[model samples]
Target: MTNWLPSLENGTGPLYIRIADEAESAIKSGTLPHGTKLPPQRDLAYDVGVTIGTISRAYALLRERGLVTGEVGRGTYVQGNSDGRVPARDPVTINYGGTRAMVPPPGKLRFDTTAAIDVGQAETVGRIMAEIASAYPGEISSYTRTLSSDWLEAGRQWLSSGNWKPEADQVLPQLGVHAGINAVVAAVSGAGDRIVCEHLTYSQVSRSANLMGRQIALVDSDQNGILPEDFERVCAREHPKAAFIMSSGQNPTLVTLPLSRRKEIVDIARKYNVWLIEDYLYGGMIDDRIPLLAELAPDRTFLLNGLSKSVAAGVRGGWVACPPHMSQRVRVTQKMVSGGLPFLLAELSARLVLSGAAGEIRSKVLTEIGEREALVRQLFAGKEFRSHPRLPFFWLKLPEPWLSGTFKQAVLDADVLIDDEDEFKPARSARVYHHVRVGFSEGRERAISTEGLKTIRRILDQSPLGTSAIV
Candidate 1:
């Protein structure tokens, strides 16, 4: 055992953190090799002229970082040479070459990316970020490797806009809903575990499950969304570990599960003892309050919401409300997967919620989406489409002789981009629905979307002659 002594300098952030930083640096440089026993807390405290509590805190932080480990009787020992190295884990990649890759050419109309149009919220976010940066310079400049209680409360307050009032301890800030879904799935189910979702669910959820090596099971859904009987049948046969559902204004489909349907689904989940993962991505846009599955099955539910759809996708701030018993496990998995949530973004989200800016932004975005949706509804009046007025996208059920692939290609050739149903289906799902998700919020102005919609209408009305390439 070497007599370890870390220089405690003034103007450092904290005595404990400084000590931990120096210790980590030493371990990485091989000055303190693996299995090297650290000095006793009292001895190190005296040598560094700091309180024993400070040394103890430093040791605890080191242990948390996996740089050291403490034994019950013996003192702490350096774990391994991981000074500034991140944990070795395979990256989650989703190939976007099929229907998922619908990037339009420059200057072309885009009706694929489901994002809320900017309604002056960017300026508000910038101003608030500046204020937060001035007020909490250290926070913005530092890495928030852990989700603090204050941020958790901030997340809860942010969720209050959607009528989701989870307990403070139950809320955990995530990078975004996408990351939240991945973390919750990873926490509840292991690789090769059975996971179930709607037949046409969010593509990211299915992609994340595949990345985590989970087996995805798709259940049939009707116009009202996931049928309780279908869910029960799948649960009984597959015995899935969990089910992911977007209760309100589901992606691409825009179907808000009615309260009765929600209750029935919750009951089925309870009966099967399966965990329920609720994704409220469009909760802020919904005017009607549908009971969240988390509220229904708090003991076995993990609810996810984010500012990406409601506010802006670039914000990348979101929260996951987990069962009290599963909170720690979810947080751990989140940390392990993404190295913890973005503190500055979470703080920005908190400021937006606390200052009431998020609500104002949501109002502006909803108004814009409503206006666009109304125009689209009028343009496609009497057309076969399913949509919620508040949602940014809608499912346009293809007419006979017009396959999804052909329609998508026709529109793409006309300089418009849209997502087909194949992008949303699970890999093992045998069911194929011929529909395309048309988004109204991606264009810079309503006219761009209007032009794109007109082109789609024209194509739908025209005969399929000379368009064999699309087929």
Candidate 2:
């Protein structure tokens, strides 16, 4: 390397991201050639007037971007960029995974969101709100600093599954899983820390972490979900503060991590002392008796579940069951980050769950999902895709010559919206998979969903090339 010094001037965002952005510009401009080993972290930090930690995070960001690869002993080196993931803060690529949602266009079938199908739970929510209005008029007008014991008890009951019900004191309610995830991240990690995740997953947290000045570390995975060995490798290399996973019915991929796999992951997490955030939002809908991460490794795991997917999305209620004495840290972080849960919404959610209305509504929602899933079975029968009996979405691997992005655009042309494989990625990945997650839960009626699936199937049945109809 010929005296490579990244100019921190004229850059925006966090210091590390500015550094990474500068490095990216240099690489693209051929200033940093392929295989050129960059300056040592400490040396570069001294030269650039930033801390070693800043340089470390900047290097980590570069690796996540696939612009550079690091050796164990040697410094990070420049690599030729391939069309993988977009830069983490790119305005153009922020559309992935509904990070920024566009209101469904007229006549467009929205198979993009897994938001709970409205099961007339609003009626219950309205009723509960009215009761709270009448009974707790003073509480509604005031801020929610300390929630009631009823809220914790409601969370305990709502999040409990199979043999694993956390103690009421261990539970703290948040606005929803995303907010809870943000709080858990805030509580466990400092700025510039790495958050590890499977390459494809629910990406809202990935974006959320980046916005909060945390870096994302990608772990390689398979159809069965996140790999334990890769998780361990990332643990050792990235020193991630936390790992987020969906044990049952992982989003987008729809693969439930097996019991053995769950144990292996927990073991690796224990070995590395990495905090594990078990996002059970989707899992709460399933009756699988698989061991929870919280159950297996109670000390290091956080159990996150919400009313968003299983019951009413509008309620926006979520709960986090902490490990041992960890509740206070996460509880404070939740309050600080999300401005605490609204008093009215919190009470409403608690009343619904406490009164057993949420469960009844969830059952109805699942029944509707099952009906839609059956429709998917009948429509896309024998097609190559993964579907859960309870998951609101199906992961459909596109046929040869049909790239995911192109297919997504084609589906958009047909007025049906679905998520491309890229939507699930936290960052640009070296490995590419041509898959799309077709969510059926967003439809107001099965007839509307049928038309949407038919649209997707039509695109899938035809080729994109010479003999193709997608042209």
Candidate 3:
């Protein structure tokens, strides 16, 4: 280890913050290069004449900033040289009339986003919104901190389509699932607190945790979804402030947690008194038979559901069913961040649900997604990929000799876009897996999606030497 000591003289703010700032400066200046081992916490504390707790807090802050990584017995080390910024991946381009265009150039086949395909929903929503605007002209122009009674009832009715049911008063309208998740995390957890998630999960949750200054502790998961044993282990070790899980058709992996596993997770959450953030983002796409984490742990669960995945992304309407006691706190937090949900969007969403347009659109979209999934399955019959017939994405485990970045680049070179595993991984997790999430929902036409799948297969079938390496 290098004999390095951060200058604490003339420090202004908290001592721990000053320590973290100095460490960040050292890292950026190359004084503490990547992979350089940091001194033991106790030794640094003794040298700085501060308590060990202060040093520990400073290190925790650094870890959250992605400036350092810690091992069980090996201590902490600097992570990267770019001051915690993950360098952007090279854009995939295509040659067009003596010019090169990005993979997702105008009208190109896009398979990277998990957005819902249009199933005649846009016209329906537009009609409903038009009707709503005509009927409630004054309401559309005004701001509403609290959802109207009719809108609340609509939210309750929409939630009834799932396994859990909550009263309108317990539901808070959010801009979307992302906004709801950020508000809930901000309300329930604090900076430096640990948040638990599946080893392979949604990227939005990871981003929300990072933005809120929380550390993510990833738990192991199997085919049946997140393992209860691993959840218990993480809870006991990290004492996470909350656990965010997508119980149905988990993102990327598409593994739904069976009822038995849900019960075990609920039991563990109860035992540890950890809050549960149940993400039902893909719940509407699948059947409603599976048990929900919110149903199992209602007292501590925040049920997140929205119309973005089932209806159209433009809707941007969602709700967070909070515990009866915490409803007001969540509402206050949401108001503090975003004045409130857009009255017009909420009214439009409510009209869609109340008028049965949302249900009709969801059914049509699910049918289309099912057909696409069948095509994908037949196209990659023997490939090692995880998918649900109704889900929007496929988790393709890359074959040997092809790492995640390499495979992603190859697919991009062939004019297709896909998300690599690193996008979904939590910071500080030591686990590494080579996989890509191929989404079929972005392409409304089956032929376009089929073409994208064919392009991916062609790349996958190529030899390592045939594909150019990403410099």
- Clash number for candidate 1: 0
RMSD of each: 21.3, 11.7, 11.6
The pairs that clash in candidate 2 are 85-428
lDDT of 3 by residue, 121-229 (tens): 7788778878888997887777775568877777777665444578789887788888988889889988999999888887667766776678888889988888899
Model 2, span 1-471: residue lDDT tens: 558898877855667668888888888777887778898877888998986656765775576466787764666778763543333345434333343246777888888989999767777788888988999888888887787999999999888889779999999988988999999999999999999988898888898898788999999888778888889999999999999888888888877888898899988988888999999998889868788888998899999999998788878998999999999999888878988788888788888898988889889889999998988888888788888778789999888767675567567667888887767888656456888999988856778888889889988887653221111
Please give the ranking of all candidate structures by TM-score, highest first, separated by commas: 2, 3, 1
Residue 264 displacement in candidate 3 (angstroms): 1.5
Looking at candidate 2, the ten consecutive residues that score lowest on lDDT are 462-471
Best by TM-score: 2
Residue-level error in angstroms, candidate 2, position 308? 0.8
Clashes found in each candidate (C-alpha, N, C closer than 3 A):
0, 1, 0
Q: For candidate 2, what's the RMSD?
A: 11.7
TM-score of 2: 0.79
Residue runs of model 1 more than 4 Å from their true location after superposition? 1-103, 146-149, 161-164, 466-471
In candidate 1, what are the lDDT values of residues 1-471, reduced to their tens digit? Answer: 888799776335667668988998888777888888998877887888976646765775576466787764577887854453423322332232333444556766778877768776778888988888888888777778666676788778766545558998899888998899899999998989989987787867787788778988888888888989989999999999999888888887888899999999999999999999988778656846777888888999988878887787888988988888898999899988888766678888877776778878888888888888888888888789987768888889877666665566567667788887767876644455778998878755777778888988888776444332211
Clashing pairs in 1: none
